[model samples]
Target chain A: MDKYLNSQIAKIDTSGIRKVFDLASKIKDPVNLSIGEPDFGFIPDVAKSLHEAIDSKCYKYTNTWGLSELRVAVAAKLKMTKKSDVLPEEVLITAGASGALDLLFRVITEPRDEIIIFDPYFMFYHELPRMLGANVIVLPTTKEFWPDIEALKKNINKKTKAVIINSPNNPTGAVYPERIIKDIIDVLDPYDTLLVSDEVYEDFIYDVGHVSPLCFYENTILVSSFSKNLALTGQRVGYAAGSRGVLMAMAKLQQYTYVCAPHLAQVAALQNLNLDISNYVSEYKERRDLIYDMLKDTFEIQKPEGAFYIYPKVGDGEKVALKSIEKDLIVVPGQVFSKSNEYLRISYAAPKDVLIKGANILKEVADELR
Target chain B: MDKYLNSQIAKIDTSGIRKVFDLASKIKDPVNLSIGEPDFGFIPDVAKSLHEAIDSKCYKYTNTWGLSELRVAVAAKLKMTKKSDVLPEEVLITAGASGALDLLFRVITEPRDEIIIFDPYFMFYHELPRMLGANVIVLPTTKEFWPDIEALKKNINKKTKAVIINSPNNPTGAVYPERIIKDIIDVLDPYDTLLVSDEVYEDFIYDVGHVSPLCFYENTILVSSFSKNLALTGQRVGYAAGSRGVLMAMAKLQQYTYVCAPHLAQVAALQNLNLDISNYVSEYKERRDLIYDMLKDTFEIQKPEGAFYIYPKVGDGEKVALKSIEKDLIVVPGQVFSKSNEYLRISYAAPKDVLIKGANILKEVADELR
Candidate 1:
């Protein structure tokens, strides 16, 4: 053996979330909050659409950018959100949000390019930038888990190629306020840095409106996927949208990588994007609300403005996770997200009954730990 | 906008095959043969397995490596070929052969690492190595489209990190004879260069026994996907088996890419692997024979020994491609594969009726040119 592992690949530690999940899976009746996946089955109509698409022989390689119709649908959705003027040409559908992120990393970051990310971030953001041989500079978020404008401004430097922001943030469901988003953009605008916004959880915000970097920055690259909103995690369809220059670059990179997302999944996503999902979104909102109430009353947790998660403060994050495992409850330790060891992110995207059962079990586990 | 695209992203050219297909798609009733996809549908049992798996909620993210069971199944299958002493731990199920190849390129090639690839190769093997910021040195194949050991030896340099060989070669369908494969391995043995064997069409050989480089070389990295042999192109499941070192490196790279293949597809592929597909293979062999007979007898073209493709000499490849398009017959110009403007690679993997219809149309087109 050459003993010559690529430095970039060697730098990405195996995901701690996966490590804990592996251990949790070995335990009987473990409640899995470590996984950020939405627990809802894919929307009935969406599932039907996939079944129909598969049977219709849409099971061939799609365009490297994605199915034209699906791209058009994504463009239309973006238009509705009043983001930048997006056409099908400006969208590159990917395997998932993770895949989109990977493409963005490959397109934007050369070795030694600096990427700024907020602390207590989606851990993958940190790992991905590093894997691309980019220097990841972490700016700590405010106490509210929102983007800290001053901290972000301080981190900007000439070598910074991009800033990654996950609004309706994972691990902590802190939806960055518009003012904060604008301020962050203002700082990035003068620096020639691309703002990479991960809005996979854009549809899951509770009280606050989801703000997209696409609205304020021409250089912004938006990454989102159907994994969360459509419960299509298994289908692995998502997209990256940006200025034509960035998207074109990413599209070329995608061609050499995986060619395109699965055609059947693209068709299903196209169908779902066009159809009315108001009922599902509303139901999800209800679940989020119900889970919020239960968690606030039973455990000391910070309520999130958007996304289906709560970052609950518990002493010794790993210890709390281990204690939860004893009760067959699965939750990710905050240490997985950052060096912080006092919080755990709990997902509320499961069905109401499962949430209720899980909440009760979590409450009992917390009490025993205290 | 920053004018600096990532060096890695800028190096990849858009897929030549996909570009040809895009142009071909515009023509009505075209007898398309440019795509490398299998012409057969999923085996009935595989389709049934997929349907059942999807309905049973197997549609979730598998482990980042893959579903453990699928890896085990793949390991057992590799044992039959006696190619490598591959264990489940040495397999990482991917979205497709393309996905596996992407992972390999990312993990094995650092900036400026030189990779050797045969000319008239699968365009991706050339494109992907370049995309990783690696130097690609093309060693032209022998006159018969087989590996030229002397040419490979001349190209091997200290900077060479890997050499790619695609047996049952694309565009040419010339399977490197066993002795040729061994000679190529012996050439690489002294350099500690990684041998990447892409055997996507492993089972499609007409008469010759498949010889894996892993059979003789410990450094060989074998890449195969279910798209061809199992007729599951859209499902996008594949596996890479190699020395534990190479597999580990690929696994790390995969972690930062798409994370893992879709869980449901893995389950479907697992079932498909165990199912008897002798009928499917037999049918493909029959189609290959039929196409070979038609081309050799009617068009006076040389017959290919393996893979469902035949590259016949044509006058001015691009002109012939355009002429075929005018006649509603789509065949890939050899220029797309290389500098050769004298041949067109036609796929014979279509349904018997379609292939017959296409062959007659092709003969008419060829006669017009004559």
Candidate 2:
């Protein structure tokens, strides 16, 4: 039989995160923190909304852009947080942050177009750009896990189509502060480069205010989902909002891709957005604090200002990860995110007891490695 | 802003079916015979299964292929169909048939590959192939909607990668007879062509036994969804089953596209598949009978062997479509399905009352045109 796969399939590796996740599933009693999903259940009202939607026959296909009411709600939410003056026309609901990211890269990049990403970044971001036939330029971040603005400025050139920013950062969970966000935006401001900001963890920020590049730049496409904030990861509802011009382009791409986000999920997200989700925010913050305290006392770990992860420096991060696996505690090695192999990302999104058990196992593994 | 959109975005025109649909949505008390969706509500037990899934925490991401249980169920279902001996590894649950179709096009066709389609086919099939940078070789079926095997054989060249067959076809409601299907397969048997069978309406066939190309061809990729069969369109649960090779290639492509199908939907589909769905199938068969009787009495329409649509010759399909719109009835013109503008396709998936109302409006329009 002819090789049925496309060339792009061979070029991109299966996600390292997914590989570890699959491994964790087979091991009995494994405490998994490998995948980048919030461990909380879907908020009660969100689940109720979904059940109501299914009963209402909201399971049919929605408009290709998405459900209008959901788009309007997303626009309203964006307006409040980032001062983004986008209307519903400028929002495109997608499968998830992953879907939005893939669409953005595919629509914006032609073959050989250059997209810049900060290293020690979301691994999928790097993989997506390459899969779309674009060169991914990685500008390494500073020691504190913020984008190196100087490196970003130097990397900007005419071929640069977009620069992807994730805050709070995946794997590391380092939220970029406002001044640094503005600095990065200013550097790209001179060029006609689009800024792709993934703020899926926006509601999970701890000490710092979530800074949106959309606030400083009109050319930004802000991608987010209810997965993290409302604990609806399996629902797979997300949106990308930006200038009407950019969104219209993305919408056309989406029409050719998956048509629209799943309708039932869209209704659930619409309700999730409208309802008060302060309880989830507070609960996650408590979990983050507890995990941070444990890591700080035992290991050299940077306290994340946001997101559900803490990157702790353990000697030979991969070896530590393997040791944790032996102890039935699963964590991601730093090399999955970047070249750094001294640190591992430990998720605090699990229940308090699961986190406690995993943390104790991690401490034992670290001591054995030392 | 340097036109942040890729050149390919400009190449796609929004589906022509959508334009008529938009106009239909505005018509007060309109009889919508335009949408291709099954108009029945989800089976009560299926809805209950979904509700239970949501109440449980099936809201986390499933395996990228789908939930293992769902895959196993799908594989068993495929086995029952006797299309091909497929395993769980040879099945992938997708968001909908739309997602599966898009992924199939993406993985199978590289730039400049050729895909064959029967003219007067499902409109989306034409659009999707074009979107993938593949040139479509359209062979017009006979006036009675049977495959033109000679023309199909003539179109096969070194570049021809796949042929799309929508049995119990959309727009025309034509089901290829067993003899015709075997003839089409004979034409493709010698060539290195992949038969892409879209059997979304497999369960709705009135008189004919549905025979998927997979039954004869080992290289077939079968795409289907529970949307029509279980009336769960909005739930967005579908699957592609075929040879292990084709499924693996699609899985790699899906990993880059949307990752996986929604978790809760997969759970619902899994549970629903276990239940006897004879009642849903029987209800659709009744609706199909009512439409066939009405169309034969009211206008010059061929009795569709299967599916929910009937293509009736109306003087200048576009003009009849406009007249139907004026009378608050919505139907897709044949021009949307192909370049031919001589017929209109009306869906009979609605309740008998609604279908009768639409048929009356269409009859009036046809009489006026005559």
Candidate 3:
């Protein structure tokens, strides 16, 4: 039955995150730090606005790009933070940051074009380009998950179509510092490369706030979601801000793909774009610090500057991860996100007590391994 | 700036349907017959169910393949119509039927793979496979818009990866009879091509009821949306039922694309699966008959068998369509759907009074052209 299917899709493995997602659902009483969903509910006002939007039934398919107001809202939010002015014409709202990547890559990539992805990035980034038959060049970040500028310089060339950088990154939780980001941009100085930034975790920063690639690069697409801040991960709604030419192409691809992102979500987003979420950021930071304290002495763990995850190096990660699961603590092994199994990505998006219980299991496994 | 982007995406003309959609919003008191949107709103029970789902805060992301119960619901719906039993595993709910097609062809198409598309079909189908650099073989149907068995058989070959057939079709509004469908199936007897049926208008058929490709072919992928039937065009939820292998692959692709259809839409669908829309279909039929009566004597017109559109032979369709708009009427030129300028598609999906006003204006324009 599958004989006539696209061979590349067969070669691309299903995401390991989904594997853990399904496994966590089936297992009983596991402290799940596997999935990256926020451990919070929707903000009060945002929830109210969404219900009102639904009641109105005004939430039909928006313009192929998005509702005019929502696109303007996205631009307004970006313009307030970025160094350069952002425009509605330069934005395309999407199903999620995931959907943005799907449309972006599909519009930009010809088969065999090279997309250089930083190693240990989001799992979908690993698969989405490959599904398009594009060659993915995985560049490993140095210690502390920093983008290695020299390595990036060596890789950038006439063939490099795009570079995917995730700040406040998934699993690793390493927020790319603005200085190094500028350095990486310098590396792409001689060639034309689209800088694609996944900034979905922008609201969860513990130290330096999120720096969009828009601040440094003209040819950049900044994609982020309300999934983390608004606690609507299950609601797949996000947006991409980039050059008008690229965004227009993405919007065209979107018409043939998802049609438009959920209209209700887009409306709610417009209503709550300014609602405060600093408390959520602070809470995530406290959890990040707590986990760092617990694992810092026993295991080599990077203290996350932002986002809700901490990547801890552990020998034989698969064995340790499986062993940790036996203790009713769910942690996704790093090998799932990379070519090697030297570390495990532990999400601190869980609540405090759950975080403590999961951290204790990690310490227990680390002590035994040491 | 687009030098590195896929050339095919540049070639994708954004749907002219959207142009009409936007224009309708602005034109003051134009008897609009341009868009194919269902004139009816969702029934009270379905609306209530949707609101209840939203208020309950259960509208989170469903399983990537979709909520299991929703898949089961879709399967059961298919079972009632098909000769053979269908299973939930063969069903993958999507953002819309648009999302279903996007994922399906992406997984099945290699570059330059020949996908047979019946001419005068949905605008998206023309652009989708071509976006992947897949060769689109356009087969013009007979004058009555039936799938010509000889033309179809001549196009069948080893390179043919799929055949896209839309029944109760858009624009042309031709619903294939079961005998012609069987003959088309016979043409595929020698090849390994997947039969893809877009049945989004299944419920709106006037004369002969909808015949799913599933009944005759095991390799068929049947995709339909709740948009037309439920009047939830903006809600972005639909399903694809096919062989387990293809459905599974589609689900994997969806995990990175739209992720899942809106959870609220799926929940509402579960509550209202038995809710009838036959009255809505009957209304469309009446409107269809009304428009046909007005134009039948003035021009060469094929009475629509099903669906809410009439393709009338009007000389210089673009010129007539433009002049019709000046008379405070809206009509889409046939050239938007095909090369020919002789026929313009008139949607009777408008209200009775609106259809009357629009049809009179159409007659005025056509009388001069004739």
List the DockQ of the predictions in order. 0.53, 0.61, 0.61
Query: What are the per-residue Cα lDDT tens digits for candidate 3 across A1-370?
Result: 3776788787567655555556566677788887678766667777787778767775467877888888888788787877657788888888888888888888888778888888787878888888777788988898989887877888788778899999888878998877888887888766858889899888888877677779678888888887777766666788888788888888878877888887777887888887888888788889999889988987787788888889988887777887887777889988788887888998988888998999888888777777
For model 2, name the residue pairs that clash.
Answer: A59-B234, A60-B234
Please tell me which predicted candidate would have the highest DockQ against the true structure: 3
**Tens-digit per-residue lDDT, B71-98, candidate 1:** 9889898888755678899888987988
> What does candidate 1 score on TM?
0.92
lDDT of each: 0.79, 0.81, 0.81
lDDT of 2 by residue, A307-350 (tens): 88888888788788877887788999887887678888888778
- What C-alpha lDDT, on a 0 to 100 scale, does residue A15 get in candidate 1? 62
Residue clash pairs of candidate 1: A31-A330, A33-A330, A205-A306, A206-A306, B95-B236
lDDT for position B40 in model 1:
57
Query: Candidate 1 - CAPRI tier?
Result: medium
Interface RMSD of each: 2.2, 2.2, 1.9
Question: What is each model's TM-score for chain A?
Answer: 0.93, 0.95, 0.96
Deviation in Å, model 2, residue A337 alpha carbon: 1.9
True interface contacts reproduced, per candidate: 0.51, 0.66, 0.62
RMSD of each: 2.9, 2.2, 2.1
Higher-TM-score candidate of 1 and 2:
2
Q: What is the C-alpha lDDT profile of model 2 across B211-250, one tens digit per residue?
A: 8887788888899988777777766779998877767767
